[model samples]
Target chain A: MAILDPTTAPRRSQLNQRHVSSHALFKELGSNLVVSHYGDNDSIIEEHSQAQTLAICDLSTLPRIGFKGAGAPSWVEAQKLNLPAMANTTVLQGSGSLVAKLSDQEILVLSDIFAQSKDVFHLSEQAKIYHKNYDKQVYSLPRDDSHCWLAVSGTLASEMFSKICGVDLRTHKFSHSHIAQTSVAKTNAVVIRNDLGSTPVFYVLSDISGVEFLWDCLLDAMQEYGGYAVGVSALQRLTKEH
Target chain B: MKLLTCPLNGKRNISEFTYGGEYHAMPDHLTSSPRDWAEHVFFHDNVAGIVTEWWCHTASSFWFLAERNTITDEVIRTFKADEIYQQRVEFTAVASETQS
Candidate 1:
């Protein structure tokens, strides 16, 4: 098989430069390119273990979309998406997509790691096809171009987040599928708790323009806990365990 | 860092908030004089005691009303703007022309 170059992929992460400098092996997920792992082929298992301890993975290239405004809730429901009962909560759909209710009138949809879920893609396509048919008050927010998504996982993830974020993200305080919209390292971001299997994972989304700064800040905060970056494969492996 | 509770987003570091200004009831644009418009838009009471003010959660962009003691720097309470603004107020061109 020919090795795929991330630079030539249809979509790439904003931290592509950082991954390239770290000797990252790239793989294609859907049409997007993401880091498969770092180091030699034999190190993938080691990376998976490292992920259980502490690791950050870039999922910025994944499919994610948002809708907001007065009619957003009913409009999303009409599309067969189940929303969380309250604001700042999330619901994992049977279709493998996750819907996060940011507020009564806003919801963000994210695709599963394997890229098997077509909910995000479908929502976007539906909007494009039925722009006039949908509720006028329900507007689409294409987060792929506006926000950069990163996943911080493992046992020490919360401890690392405390260094920069104001929210109390300790497992007990912030459970799975809970959302926090606050400042992290002085940059505004949305932190959502979405565990992968038994591993505690928090997805952080921030302005794409300031992603490099936020990435550096997160890395610096995690350094004291001996945390480092892993690749998507490590995360994919974690989900298979327990 | 000081903490402030947002009506919608809960408590957060003060740095995450932007002080919009004192919350003032809008003047009747069609009948109010130019001086009223100037005072409403460009000036502030800067009250020394407890007063209602506007604050926005920078992260969520959620704006709410806060009653605080300016002297003690203590926030008395926070509430959603909807509590006071029950209906949408639109200014028509006629109102704009009257103000002009």
Candidate 2:
């Protein structure tokens, strides 16, 4: 008899069913089958080509969670989480993980660390402990299943975003570690500026159900700037080089 | 786009906030007449001068008070209500401690 590993099962993204036929290579990344590359070439060439151009990668499989309510601030503080004191700011903690204070009461934590390390999971588990201990005002807002995360980066990234976003997101106006909870592509989305390499990169978080529509809208905008879709492997390499 | 200064997320578009109506004192239901209660509930002076009003940021759900002029629609200032309330509570606590 063979032992079955449940964790090895390939999890799918919201756009998985729609994009499965389009991808040429699929890699299992932490229980998720993500596109390793789209065409014949390897992800390295794809990454190198995107050095001056734009590349949009789906990162919905990343471990992300939210904390909100009156006691959320204190709870986060108690946990000794590395978050900014002011709202609309982000802090990088434990490898490439980001902790964003969307507001005084609401927080969004994203684990961008390479290889989906145990360190990020440990940080997320601390929130569960806080929820168990302080169940009064602090509320758990798990976003893993609710949000579709995307990484849009490269030289013309800001230009592509300007087409859909209302706010000015140029590096001069919106620097690294800044967050904007505004309309993107006519939809409510949270945009965070966490650059990858020398290129400007942003993490866009929106409703999971609208992921396909948002992806199409973004790709349409990227078309004018010669942008294309890159796999998660290429994105990981870009972040590592930074 | 009209910009409203949020107490937390400073200077955001007015569309991002929801108007919470005028801020006024509630009539004492026990001592006041029905007419007074009705006036408190339905009537508004709609003054052209600067008046305090309630506003909430839709994204963050942060409720705050803004002083604005109805005529020019100019927002004079904006601040968190809890900040003022906390100060009052601290002052009262200090006063009681001094008296004791």
Candidate 3:
């Protein structure tokens, strides 16, 4: 069933709801915020929550591209500080995970969400090239998409996410690069599984308006785990250490 | 964070944009007055599903019309404003008829 069109997709759950939280992300024992989830995996979320009670979502906004052609490898290498492995190689050549030239500038390269040392350099380099050749305009992103990214962390992270999205949360099967375009509480979203060794992270990408409902559904499912909500400001304090 | 791709360039985030509202449709300029122009700039008729909006590439200084589904944030289509507007008059008529 199409996630975007509810009429086409069967509705097994309500669209709007919110999870209850006894404390704010900042008010928690350690650094944490309980407000809304910005989409990020645990490596990204740990920035907000600290104590075992609080959970955080990674809010690193990244860029994406669809590209292909002979110039692909050169284009990808040119954009990144450490060139990626050849188009089909299983290994990722670069040391810095912060910068991702997913595919060549031609193939679809979903760049890393967070801005690291290299993203800035690529932006400036592209801009310089564009200036040199006014005829050829270069496209680069300064901010990630304004998508409401939600993360369900803690021991119950997968359980909470499964409650919202029908897809399985088994760790081994749905690793990175494994994407599921599904629905959560009547809203369409792209769920990506980010493995964080001990606790697996789920990246839920959806509209801002649907965030309240999405958060609520997740909290309800996670109620058994005694989960709490956190806001973006609180996330900053949580991530300060990292 | 809004990520957009120009047909000319490649992937770009939405921060480089000013969402102008559904694109590929004209203001009925032949029958429209200055008031219509003002309304187009100041007013809006928000829809729940698919919509076309004008996006000004603030960083690149280019403008294009993007067809985006508001609910999903998925871009349905996009085109250069200068080239597409000429045909928008006819496109608007067809779109209005479909809505009715």
Who wins the lDDT comparison?
1
- Report the TM-score of the second chain of model 3 against its true counterpart: 0.64
Task: Give the total clashing residue pairs for model 3.
Answer: 35
Residue-level lDDT of model 2, residues A122-207, one tens digit each, is 65688667657775667778788888899888878888888888778888899988988877887778889998776678889988
Give the residue spans of candidate 1 off by over 4 A.
A133-136, B28-33, B87-91, B94-100
Q: What DockQ, on C-alphas, does every prediction get?
A: 0.71, 0.30, 0.02
**Which candidate tops DockQ?**
1
Q: Which consecutive 10 residues in model 1 chain B have the weakest lDDT in total?
A: B91-100
Residue A89 displacement in candidate 1 (angstroms): 1.1
TM-scores (chain A) of the candidates: 0.97, 0.88, 0.51
Stretches of candidate 3 off by over 4 Å are A1-77, A81-117, A124-145, A230-242, B1-100
Which is the better candidate, 1 or 2, if ranked by lDDT?
1
The model with the greater lDDT, 1 or 3, is 1
- Under CAPRI classification, how is model 1 graded? medium
Stretches of candidate 2 above 4 Å error? A1-11, A41-44, A113-115, B25-48, B84-100
